[model samples]
Target: MAISGGRIVIAFVNVIGLALLSCVADGAIQLAGRKHSLHIVRRPRGRNLAGGDPTVFNVMNFGAKTDDKTDNHGPFAQAWNAACQNIGPAKLVIPPGTYMAGQLYFQGPCKGSNPIIVEIQGTIKGTTDISEFQDDGWITFEYLDGLILTGGGTLDGQGAFAWKHNDCRKNINCQHLPKSLKIHRVNNSVIHDIKSVNPLGFHMFVTMSSNITVHHLDISAPADSPNTDGIHVSGSSFVDISHSKIGTGDDCISVGQGSTKVSISNILCGPGHGISVGSLGRTKGEGPVNGVLVKDCTLSQTTNGVRIKTFSKSTPNQASGIVFQDIVMDKVQNPILIDQNYGTSRKKAGKASSQSKVKISDVLYRNIRGSTNTSAAVSLSCSSVFPCERVELVDIDLVYDGTGSTKIVQNPTLSALCMNVKVKPGEHGLIVMEAKVSLGTL
Candidate 1:
């Protein structure tokens, strides 16, 4: 007998009520007299939970073991298929236990109007061996819209062994290490209350996606771990990353080329390179970066804070309309850096004849107060050929504290350095630096 849609809703509510009561009374009900497993609450037949109830597809029912030894990739795939095929809202639940998994990819335009939710309650540990996964990441959720990935669980990359092979700095032909999590082409999604630890590469990589928000995430790796950027966004736009704690070796949040309209606020970054706008012009014909805002963020003991870097001798590129305001730094090496000759050889950059093709304009730094370990608080090493234009600094109070030491210190002074850059007064009608060029109100 086919149950009507209305009856299905009532049944679901009743079941949920009973389940809650049982949970309140004695924690969890045993399923089929199983010693350590909870009962699986099945939904009614022939009726979907589109707007009424959500079908729960527990991964354990599909032969996933909680011992953290067996590979649970097959069970996860099985559960995902069932959830994606459902005619309504569905949730794939990972219960409270440590589970070992190889790379798992969830790709979907689900069969329902509502979004699919992944409620992870247990730790998902990835394999240490790099050859286990085919892609450059452990878990990838792609081509899914209106998705929510939440729960107070951990994604453990166990990257201590893999970090030894990362030689990308010395060798240009290095193999890229696997990131912890990759979200590609997924729109209108939110990821919260998650922790990614010890990734061999970037902790979270978002590319070719839009309208996404990531909040309340704790991402960490060792300070010496190479290339472990906390969150890296490339070729994506309309993203918001807030209220997060990120500590790693590389940039806390790196906004790469072709990305625009990104907002990063209230971020706690430490023991890493601070937030950056670009290493743009690395390749020819790359797009520009615009409309980026980094405000209300704190950086402690970072190598650099609030940086904008571009390579020299690259194809023509432009970076404009960027702002970094109300940021606090502590014992940072370089509090504010705008290096247009980044990654260029010293011989090539110092030739006195080479000119950078990347144009930097309309950048403002306001209310940036902090203490720096080195004397040079602000280093504006702009290109000699195409100098930075319309640069403004207002209410910047950076002082040398004489507290710590770094390798990059070269007779530090409590002053700013401007090389081949033009200055302009900001909206407040003030220029803070004493450079050789004349400053004019914008």
Candidate 2:
């Protein structure tokens, strides 16, 4: 897998090769990974799966230690309390090799029936001695309703022994380095064929869960590893991430602030930071982000593509029905963004407050085509005090192959940067960019 100009390049990865027999999205199965076969999520009407004859429970029969340094978190919590006291369908196997674990929680309301599986074929090494990570997740799965985490194993968060103590992005009172799978408040769950590597932060972190169903994953990290985000959804609600192959450094899927109906599709992001919903009103009872749907993704060399960040000290509706359709932006650097003055400080985002209170509304960017290095290919720096309502831009085809020294060939400056949102910002106005079909570049 190597494409130079159009950039793909990922030789191999597929840890166990992802396999989810259920959770119907109508049906389509080609499941390969690393270099892509994608097309998962479909065929499910069977609620909370893991049906009949399960009863496995074998973490080397509760004395787990694959010689990888012997610290299998108390034999994987005594094999998940004997498969959560096995009542019906149960299976908590973690066979194969290399195990060094430190914080393996897995608490549940489980007494069996309605799935209680946790396969993990092998290699779960995360104890580089970060003081045994007293929680912030290193494989935690709380109050599970009906979990069915898959196998294709590999959750190695050694993160080069904690990426030089990852100073929480410039030391904002740091000290939070665990994260290598933490699905809190787990409800009807289904995490498929996994393979997350190098994490000390954000690599599959769904919060306050609802009907969760993360798919065929293969998340990695290395691009100077800063934030390591690859599938992070906060406050969750009916979440469903799909056939993933994320390369992280940050935000290869980040929907923050009380997320709702989140559903990202067949993604294959790159040297990260793309696919976001919010920087979000910088913290203040911040909630309310409704229905988000990012579609068939492919963002190579990413920096920002398909984004919506808010933080002029936000939180009102903050965001609403957001959709980014059939995307494919290689050489990306800001393919399409909407930062309602995100983290200030460009002289505080050019003296911010174009009235910004956050509050965004029905947003959409359809069939977004690729190639942009940065000539500002679409940015709606919003916030004339809560602006951004029904925004639309259909079939946007981008192109501006920047080679660096501001290099651009043939009539460059492919622009789109509106301030007062090109419409109105608050008062819940009819703010829309309203582009139908053809709009510049390419």
Global lDDT scores for all candidate models? 0.75, 0.73
Top-lDDT structure, candidate number? 1
Clash tally, candidates in order: 1, 12
lDDT (Cα, tens digit) per residue for candidate 1, span 1-442: 1223111111111011121101101111111111111112121222221344789999999999988799899999999989988997889899889999989998887886777889888999988778887878789999887678887889988888988888977774477798889999888788899998998788999998887789999999999998899999988888889999999989999998888788889999998999998888778768888778888999999999999988777678888878787899888878888887777677787554555678888787766877777655667777766777766655566655555664444434454556666544323643333312111110
Report the backbone clash tally of model 1: 1
Q: Lowest summed-lDDT stretch of 10 residues in model 2?
A: 21-30
Model 2, residue 296: C-alpha shift (Å): 27
lDDT of 1: 0.75
